[model samples]
Target: MVAPPPIIVLAFFCGTSIARSASPGPARPAKPAPIAADARHKQLTFRNRPRVVRSGRMRRMNMSTSQPGTEIGYTWPIRVYYEDTDAGGIVFYANYLKFFERARTEWLRACGVDQHRLAEENDAIFIVRSTAVDYRAPARLDDIVKIISRIERLGRASVDFVQEAWREGTLLATGSVRIGCVDRATLRPAAIPPSVLAALRHGPGTSESAD
Candidate 1:
């Protein structure tokens, strides 16, 4: 029998995470894209880009241009639609998870940790270990939220990421996630690849130690 797929949870947010310098590592600004005037146009509807989940994950192809394994982080811009809110038009409590997750995956992709590649070539997978969250305010439908992903720690077998969600320059929520690399079959922790670790250590983040 096939083993059960590991549980994967998304983390949200972008701001002053881990109190690190914003020098070196992934260099591009870790901020959200400015909303276009036409984002609300009918052409920008879900019909143009259907929301679908693949393998228990959101399918976001090339959401960012940064190469994988060494980005300051990835930025995901999401428009709040009617379906994302309550009768009163405020966004529900949980959709924030969806927003930050897309950003994290893009961050991973920017760092070159393709989920497929890690599984095939290295027999490794990143599993979310824990999440610490704080919800500050309610986001309204149609508001564009930006999720930022940046590293807090690179350890022997795990990496910690601090993410945040913002609406129009205001901090809305924050998340601290610990991700562990594990063996595909044994379900045990495994050391990250030398190349991957090296990239992350040298990649965009406020790394004060030797890089």
Candidate 2:
């Protein structure tokens, strides 16, 4: 072969070296964008959301039975709606009471105590005599709120319940409510019927003796 020009050969070698250096060698994958703090918080909340099961009567969600100091009791799941929220888009403080009420009502229903039937057949009804609630955090719209209701005490004509509102694993509020049995017509305190008393005694996480 005819000898190539030294300059041409040098230029060709230089060009090949430059092309090799410039050509990407197995392009490094792009690093994912750093998740924002709020986004990360939301993702974590969604991931830790309780598992819910839908049945014929109502929806039930399984919560951490392992939470120390928390009594394993009947749980009711509530979905926060726009009406349950305030202008701030968070659940109104008073709405937690409603959530607790629903949970307690469901617990009673599970125990076979239907308030309406009790009122009609037994001439008895349950009325909230007093309630104390401590707000720890706020729940927002579209959040699933789990209300855990446990009987703390049982009286001849009254029952005290310790109810808690939780989102994921965070406790939003805690409440103690005293419910009194009353005559439907007079709204005066009445002795809890034998059937109702039996139901309360055998209720989930309840003891025969008042706590």
Candidate with maximal lDDT: 2
Could you say which candidate leads in TM-score?
2
Q: Residue 182's C-alpha lDDT in candidate 1?
A: 97
Task: State how far residue 117 of model 1 sits from its true place (Å).
Answer: 1.0
List lDDT for all candidates, in order.
0.69, 0.83
The alpha-carbon lDDT assigned to residue 9 of candidate 1 equals 19
Worst 10 residues of 2 by lDDT: 57-66
Candidate 2 local lDDT, 25-135, one digit each (tens): 887889999999999999999999999755585212222232734546788899999999998889999989889888998899889888888999989999998787889
* Model 2: lDDT to the true structure: 0.83
Q: List, residue by residue over 1-211, the lDDT tens digit for candidate 1.
A: 9754443211111233423455457767779977777875655785688676555542222222222323345466788898889877887777777776777777666666578977889998888876667787778977888776767667889877777677765767777777889999897999988877876776654234323
TM-score of every candidate relative to the true structure: 0.60, 0.65
Off by over 4 Å in 2: 1-71, 207-211
